[model samples]
Target: MNKFYTAQEVADKLKIKKTTVYELIKRGELSSSKIGKQLRVSEDQLSLYLNGAAKNSVSAQHHDYQPESSLLKRDYLLHSSGLIISGQASPALDLLLNQLPSTPGNLPVLQSHMNTYNGLYSLYFEKVHIACAAAAPEDVRSLVPGLSLTALLFCQYPMGFYVKKGNPRNIHDFPDLTRADIIFANREKGSSRRVLLDRTLKSSGISPESISGYRNELVSDYSTAAAVAGGQADVALGESYAVRSFPELTFLPLTQETLYLIMHSENLDTPGFQAVTETISSENFRRTLALQTGYDTTHTGEIFSI
Candidate 1:
């Protein structure tokens, strides 16, 4: 008979923690054999697994991992109580909280922001169950090794120059922002608005130094919109919904972008997480989001798993 290695031994060989190894077994993420009361993997089976890993078996691929119910029951212990959902400041997060079932009749929902990068790191630390971010397809690819991104919606919002509510500057599009007379406002680093501004400038072929008052950066979309509203800057890039509540600014339609919900893939099977996914697709929720803003919610809560 061939000698067999326990899960802990296999974990040591793989250089991962024993807890992760047990998690893999509980999740059915690793293969093994049951010999009476013992669970083990033969040396040959281990070598075969290593060889298959080199070739990247369909099931072994990072994107192909699926946790069965048996695994969920063993690993995910639900207490059926409160959970903290941390993300950026947005009405959508509020909408999600409102839709979740309050089992004890009333349980508070905690919301916070670490920006997108820090938010992803927070999730990796198990500090939050859900994280929200305006991630481009490329950003999604970069963030996926640690977080599994689910496409919540492609918000086709009017993202562009937030000018004073009038035809004073004649700022119609990206090019006009470079006019010698126009003073442009920008967003701070690690913000979604900042990323959009940089990309828009590159796409429009405008030199950063060429624009007047380019260094003037605001912290959030609300602040960016307010800068234009307060006449601090003639123009600034922002979303329509940000300034729609404020009558002082005008929003010009810009590019359509994707908004993603990033979370540990293990959260997908949790009851609270499942509730979030269900709420995003509900007809009532869709109607509320549509009525409040001109956001396109046609495919809200849709999953584009990679």
Candidate 2:
């Protein structure tokens, strides 16, 4: 369906008057178009406007020193905020960092525990401009409508068991986790890995409770890796990047998962967003990803739009 909202529709959605919406459009705070003398907005654009407005206001209040650029550069790359990578897609972020020119100036990049669903929520709230997620095709199709997306070929990473150092118990496959002595460190819900694991177990006629140590959960793949490294658990299921981070553990390849670049469509043409896309698609970037331990770069930068 076409995404078009009238001034009255916007006013009703935001609990304001039609005149107020008109004023916003006049001041260029909201995006609209002329359709036979009537103004209209994209449903996605309105959601972004409302979300960005609230977030920018709170941010301005906290800083106590809001600059003129904050109010003026809403449509441009005038602001630089730290990029968050959820659950350790280090190779992709590394490629992004290398491609960004340092001679111009340095930019901030911070890693956080933002899984698939949570990362999308952050994008909706305007908390972060870009996020790395291992979301499935079906999940993307279910998101709140009206939003636009641009997916970059991140990496083809394998989903597998992270066994303790030296593979002491000789754990070979998913079925091995059901052993009485094997301690499994699980990832929380909302993570793509968790969804894959749940579906696999269900298809295999295995109740989650049948697996040992199902009661405990880790917030991220890194934490799960840490749990295995610390002898707290015998195995953890996560992506290839997690195994690369902790060399002491043995990685068992199970399945291949594609990691993608996620961002609001409005920001698609922004310099920063374009830089992110170009960086991911470059030959140097692909080589770097290929060199990174345990990642397959064959499908990097492929687009799978919802």
Candidate 3:
């Protein structure tokens, strides 16, 4: 005889909410059968779903596809010039990329959102034209040994904990993450925010094992915030921009970091590169950044220290 699991049982096994399980069923991603108005998943189906998910997660972690080769076909490449941008994801960055095609030169810009380290690595290998980072220049320089890189100051924003509304857990700083009762959500290993959080915890003499859900990793800031918002996590480290999307969550400011647009020194003279820099420095772009919350545009396009 085959065993069947209810939606709640599946949620418990997967460490997610029953509602999320129902949503998966509604979307037809999870195989389910209705039995007396209750949805149930068979043991074999559950195993199949989990195995497929694990395989996909492993695949995503192992490969970092180049933008032009992946998104642009041979026919499209013949008629258009490609400019690949890889780095941290932000609303400001999205807005700027969206406006690139309308710029005077009209180059086709493709965004490959990854962590700061991977972004820098891609830039070093000429895989991307621009790499955005939140780390300091000194740290970024250490990553690319033989290449001459230039960094342009993009914007500054507050980074901190995203917690439930009304200060429920009172999670204000890094140390609070170790509390016995708190469950934390973490970003992937290469993310800048995760790097800062781990360093702070190490200096404070806190073991990652002491924190519940320390091994639970999500891909993006919005997803991290959503996990917390959906009651799957107690707190997560992210920037102020993610808070705007989750009204049920509030941001506790911990520190501020500057965002920079990095590029190879040789690419500085290219028309595509020039177009990006010009668009970022334009009055219209500045106005757009100014209107966005949690971002400081005073030095939006300033070339800080190359």
Candidate 4:
């Protein structure tokens, strides 16, 4: 005799909400049989669905994804037996994910590195479970118009200029990048660092076009620093943590920024979501953050409504 699982049992096995399981069944992704007005999924059907979903996910990762295409990829992951975490990359968040205690279904956490704005957009659209962002509170509030969100302070870190070890250019402030001799490795548009750089340049009466390599875009803080260390640019704005990885570079503190984790209001009560929060609040995770350079975890795990 073959065993069958109820919708709720499938949810427990997949570590997802019962509603999500029903959505899968409704979409014809998961085959179900009805017996005496109750729906049940055969074990073999569950195995087939999981295998097909895995194959689709692997194929999607290799595609050249546009913004809309990326959203579709995120949706697929959200429906799979994994928690999708999208946002700015942080060692702290990575550590938290590694330390989270195993739950009933043991869902894996998938990290998606994206800019602050994109991360928030994913969360707003229900494409991701958690969004790690480093933008100002006001900016984040504007992204999710209709969705209710809960934001938590992940950590505070200093942002600054990553220059060559000797500081040959003597670049001291934001305006220095406007000097004819300087070449800047800039973050891509929509990134928090890029937004800050533009704002700072505007307030200082500096035209970005006047700065050499102003349009030279790099994706992450590490890549931005790598440009400078590799002698491709003079300076780049990035978090201090990046400096630790590139010994050939030196850091000059610019400003401190807070990184937050934003989630939908409804997910806070879910078992997986609660496990994530518990991990964030654990003493072990706190200790790990304390040991990491350039991070201040004093406010880690504190939730606020935005």
Which candidate has the top score in lDDT? 4
Q: Give the local distance difference test score of model 1.
A: 0.64
Q: What ranking emerges by lDDT with the best candidate at the front?
A: 4, 3, 2, 1
- Could you tell me how far off, in angstroms, the CA of residue 85 lies in candidate 2 after the best superposition? 6.6
Mind sharing the TM-score for model 1? 0.66
Worst 10 residues of 1 by lDDT: 71-80
Model 4 error, position 71 (Å): 7.7
Question: How badly does each model clash, as a count of residue pairs?
Answer: 0, 2, 0, 0
Q: What lDDT score belongs to each candidate, Candidate 1 first?
A: 0.64, 0.68, 0.75, 0.77
Weakest 10 consecutive residues of candidate 2 by summed lDDT = 76-85
| Regions of candidate 1 where Cα sits further than 4 Å from its true position | 1-82, 101-108, 124-126, 144-149, 154-156
User: Highest TM-score among the candidates is held by which one?
Assistant: 4
lDDT of 2 by residue, 1-306 (tens): 447788798899899999998767533356453343345676655765787789788987888656754553354122224343333335566556556653233334433335676666555545456667777655654652466776666888778889877799999877888999988999877778788888889988888998887878776688999999988999988876777678799888888888887777776666656666666767777887788655788777666555
Q: Residues 171-207, candidate 3, lDDT per residue (tens digit)?
A: 8877788898899989988788888888888999999
Q: Residue 144 error for model 3, in Å?
A: 0.9
| Steric clash pairs (candidate 2) | 153-300, 153-301
Sort every candidate by TM-score, greatest first.
4, 3, 1, 2
TM-score of 3: 0.73
